[model samples]
Target chain A: MPIRYPNGQPYSRSPKQGQAKKPLPADTYSGRGMTLEQDIDEANLYYLSQQRAVVHKKPTPVQIVKVDYPKRSAAVIREAYFKQASTTDYNGVYRGAYIDFEAKETKNKTSFPLKNIHPHQVDHMREVSKHGGICFVLIRFFQSAEVFLLDAKHLIDYYDNQDVRKSIKKTEIERLGHQVKTGLHPPIDYLRTLDAVYFNGDAKERT
Target chain B: MPIRYPNGQPYSRSPKQGQAKKPLPADTYSGRGMTLEQDIDEANLYYLSQQRAVVHKKPTPVQIVKVDYPKRSAAVIREAYFKQASTTDYNGVYRGAYIDFEAKETKNKTSFPLKNIHPHQVDHMREVSKHGGICFVLIRFFQSAEVFLLDAKHLIDYYDNQDVRKSIKKTEIERLGHQVKTGLHPPIDYLRTLDAVYFNGDAKERT
Candidate 1:
């Protein structure tokens, strides 16, 4: 017996046999089948435990239509549909500034495609920046094992200039985005880089 | 055949026949079956469409231990457990200020029970206020057909002095909390009430 996906293809777990389940890269996505989102989640947990920062990833929204009750167990959701989020994935107060951002991954080596992001998310990031929140996008080039934090403003600018190009060039991203140093406890140390961007030297001034 | 709930009682649908499905009152959970959260959700949608404010309720988090992919359609969440949220139910930017808060309803006429709120929510709201964000709670008295927006600061003061009393007196809440005027387009016009609390006279100055 095989499990079929929505598109009528079999879902497999063979690391060597399938394109979808390709062997995990040791340096990317935690290499143990952990997603980048999972890595950031663990990092958020670390941030909470240490009281270094406060952030949380919004849960995947599901529209539940029907639920079933068993004899002596919890109610089970029998019918539900995935809903598109209207806001960014992660947001919370950091130090004294509001932080909001989205995380995305790309296998493309030359550029980060804009299609990876929805128009709603881009619009949301812009809205966040307009209202004084520290907004950004965490982009991971999985093939190269590189991650960068690109300011939401910069992304919006590129989006508005789509008449010129639909994707952000690798050179532009390298020059504009801040490289996120990987850490042990919390996989991505993006905040260490953010303090330099938002706080500058004043970070030391705060308790 | 009857569907039995976890409590060993049969689920019922009629007001006369069933214990669980008794029709609610107009002011009480909309007896038409609309929960307070649903009203707030409609209000939020109105706010978004009007471009008046950007607020969103975080999704209920679920820890998916297992998933089953059926042959015909989307994957089913076969075995999952509800996860406790770290932050409040709602938080977002409004007129250049970050807004964070929780919504709760009680049947009590004289006092809103402190037990309805968790310690973590109080801590989160306090942190948000310390960082310059606006924080408060929207308390609805279903029996009284009244809703009040109480500042988180006042709530915290009462909470910290729990040795004296476990609940804040109705008089204290009525004296401190702003009465939210109901509106047509956005059911509960809490933001209008917020403008008075947070923006005050400065709201006219902001574009």
Candidate 2:
């Protein structure tokens, strides 16, 4: 069998690496630090190299309306608009299980606000899970550099009971979620916990 | 359930309509032209409103390195890099099943060229099928305006045999594919086919 690359692709990584190295970010984002997006991107690389599982963050969807071609080599977007996404931030296949998730980082140390997640995404995860897909969210507290993977079931439960509150408490997240320690390559190996949870049926072990 | 806007968000359609009217073609590259993406976008709106299922096009992922805050109202991306996406162009849940596929339009009249598709997408769809997800591609011949849904199983088969010949014959796609007739509300009612294939157990219909 041919080796499947991340995203179920079979291209040489060197090309992708070359594309990734093209002076986009000096160090992942506007100098505050590596944004949560960057951290998970590197983590995806690590997971790919070790053949852990294939997961990726979907790119920010920007609507490019006008492009100026001073030269055919360069396509500069002149007039474009940003669109809101309907699904989660990340989703991919892992160990023959469809794994979908959204990653959010909050500044508030006490709790992660539900506003960070859109309701359409909440509906999406619910539908995915109803169909037997494994869905969750990877929450990071950037100030603390702590990561937690909260299952979608918990999220839906919280979302359904909106009459209660506006946020998911950090303490509750810590208790109900699995912690993902950041690493060098594939910085966020949240799938390790996914395997132990969904596939292995030890999802309750996190509690 | 609260009403979801066109992009699957639980919001009013006012913002999206205002955004879509901005006349930027960057977001219009779904290759359907202004009317096409709008049709599908509208179709998605109808589907969501009716509670059929949730589906959406994956956003184009970009790595932003430098962003300039010219004003408190808007932030401009000064420099950014394109990232490789690891999944298909579209994915979502329908009637309790995971649906993933890429949409492609070809000008060629004789054959649907495999080159129009990336290897990574093939890998992603294969993985999606492996995980019990519903996977397929929506192929349209703009000259004829004929839309067909070809199962990923058949697509991967033809893709794997690419060494022999590098194209999917029109006859082949027609023989193995299911045609999607355009409809009101959401222009492309492919979800009807999805319900037929996934929930009603119509896989044998194509076979």
In order, the interface RMSDs are: 7.7, 5.3
Docking class of 1: incorrect
Q: Looking at model 2 chain A, report the run of 10 residues with the lowest lDDT sum.
A: A20-29
Tens digits of lDDT, candidate 1, B114-162: 8777788888876677666678899888777688999888898988888
What ranges in model 1 sit over 4 Å off?
A: A1-34, A160-164, A201-207, B1-34, B160-164, B201-207
Error of 2 at B121 (Å): 2.7
Model 2, backbone clash pairs (residues 3+ apart or across chains), number: 15
Tens-digit per-residue lDDT, A1-207, candidate 2: 777756665443342343322222221222377878778888776765665655667776665444445432334344344556777877765654566888778777788778777878897787667656678888888668888989998888888876898888988998888898677655777767777666666555223
DockQ metric, candidate 1: 0.16
Give each candidate's fraction of reference contacts reproduced. Answer: 0.21, 0.20
TM-score of each: 0.77, 0.71
lDDT of 2 by residue, B1-207 (tens): 898656564543343353422222221134345445555667776876777756666666665444445432334454444455667877766654567788877777867888777788898776667666678998877677777889999999989999988889888999888888875556788987776665575566322
- Model 2 reaches an interface RMSD of 5.3
